[model samples]
Target: MELHRNRGALVLPLVCVLGGAALLLFARDGAVLHRIVGGGGVLLGGVVLAGLLRPFRFAIGADGLTVRLPKLRRLIRWPEIDALALDQPPAEQGRPASPRLLLVPAPGVDLGLPATGHHPRDGRAAVELLDLDRVREKPAEIAAALTRHGGDRFVDVLGLRQAAFDTSDFTVGLRGYQPDRVDALIRRGQDALVWGGTLERQAARSEIERTRAEGLPVAGRGYNTTQVDAALARLSGALTGDPSTDRRPTT
Candidate 1:
């Protein structure tokens, strides 16, 4: 893997420099609004610059590299792997299989994170099946949402019973989202929740993202998009640790 990419090396510094200059330039301007707007610009620029420098995406801990597998019962944490080789998946039931990269283990040493391989397809999507190891740390908020909007059908969220969700119970209002379409999407998430297969969480995540990005005509009456989006986001977060559809990581 390439050690570094310098895309932000120049642009970030330029933004910070320009923003600071603007802040100083407006410090002497008599009109209050100009100073206020300049201050806002400086703050926004600083925030953006901080974000550009924040090492969240580039940071990795000493746990080595953790890779979760399909049907995900276990994770392989490979350490001190210095070589990469391709590993093609064996076809199952006549369907295409995953093409992966195997981190060749240190020979005869056997002292480090165990050698592992993962499908390249994982890096292309939001649902990171093979990724860093970390607990989601939030289940009560999800359970509370299920209790509030899910009604009696959503008795136990951890149980993941699809039949417990009341997809058709939405109340319509002025200038809101299309109810039928939302219900159909909700049913898809329910199916994923019920199946609990290799693609179960992935399916729910896709549905949630699609719903958030979907463009529907404003009806005379329907469900509120904000509320629906929030609920779907929670469900997606419950399924996959990444919550916001808009905030999926880019590499």
Candidate 2:
């Protein structure tokens, strides 16, 4: 599967270009400060546009995975990959948190990518730290693809239980399910998946059913109903051990 850069990321560069053009149009004649500001904006926007326009050469193939840079291209075979996991570093300053892909090579294997740090679970050194923010595919889609190809080498560090809730990416609307109630249910569902027995799982399932039957209190600007329901469906499938459900092996 070939992954492409997110088109949403192009917004900033486009804005910069427009702003630069506007400044250039409004600037008084022979105004050096205005000219500098306009030129800087255009130049910065152009640079970012060029970088984004570069082809995304990340792909999964029959033999291995391909990573392409401006001057370097390498294929990391399946045997060379020890484990692959997705990590979310804490948000710094005011920026929102973004997911990163951790590719840990097997012992004594060098994939040629720079090592950012060690994996949290096994303490194995990771060769590349890939930012998924600019990638168009959802985290779940990427995980599914990698798990299918990488086999047991793909580790779901971000538990599927939690991911069911986190990956919903629900939209806020004028009236929808209550946020706190939904969050509480998600936590209970996660607990069931992680540590609960059959009875607990059944109970969680029942609670979900009841919650849906009773309908969560609709508040102004809450999660969209469609998205929340989709997430709940996935959670229910996971609780029931549906073969189609995606989950980490308990062992």
Candidate 3:
């Protein structure tokens, strides 16, 4: 499935290029013609940029993940990915949120997602896997899709609620999960943030298994059962692609 951001903005650039072409062909006045040509060149540049950028999207299919950069499109098979995680760049306090799908490169292998469309090396020493641009869906949704398709190679580095994943927030609430236990699980999830070795990966899977098998303990006036359980189930789905059947809400 191809996940694309809305393409409505492309229309303005298309119109500019078309209108500029018309003026370039017909305008006869010397001074007027110069200005028209200049404007048309600028518009044409925008048109090219928009056209090239139109391919910047996520293409997930049975074979693997294809992340199309502004100038390059990379097709990475499932095994090539080291870790698949999601991040929402922090925004102004009350502004709208923008979430990005981040891919961590494997130990020594490269999956072909380049840092910059213009530069060859991208000037970064670190290995780059892929970054899915222009994701208009909820970050959770994208994460879920990756988990479902990524098979055994994929690891959820961001845990369940990436937008809400943090150290401080999970601290002891009047009515919430055990702080110590939850913290340990969060730490395990963080270990996979950048595709740790086998032990780290095993630990991440272990936490998911434990969370799925045995529910967390609740202290006096602990976190709301429904809320906490629902959150965990969502995380479970994003991690295992087998969300708790009992926990899911039905129509």
Residue-wise C-alpha lDDT for candidate 3, range 1-251, written one tens digit per residue: 67766555456667777666666666667868656675876577686656646656567777788866664577777666655545433333322234445555556765544532211112123333333334456545665777678754444444433332343343335666654455456545543433344455456767867875787876653444555555555443434322222232110
lDDT of 1 by residue, 1-251 (tens): 10122344437556755866676685775767767766676676777666445442211223333333323232223333333322233434322233333344334434234434432223211122212112222233433442443233222322233332433344557887766666556656654554445466687777678657776545667778677766666666656632333232111
Cα RMSD (Å) per model?
18.5, 7.1, 13.8
**Which 10-residue window of candidate 1 scores lowest in summed lDDT?**
124-133
Best by lDDT: 2
In order of listing, the candidates' clash counts read 1, 0, 5
For model 3, name the residue pairs that clash: 175-221, 175-222, 175-223, 176-222, 176-223
State model 3's lDDT: 0.52
lDDT order of candidates, best first?
2, 3, 1
Off by over 4 Å in 1: 1-169, 241-251
Each candidate structure's TM-score, on Cα atoms with residue i matched to residue i, is 0.29, 0.62, 0.42
Ranking the candidates on TM-score from highest down gives 2, 3, 1
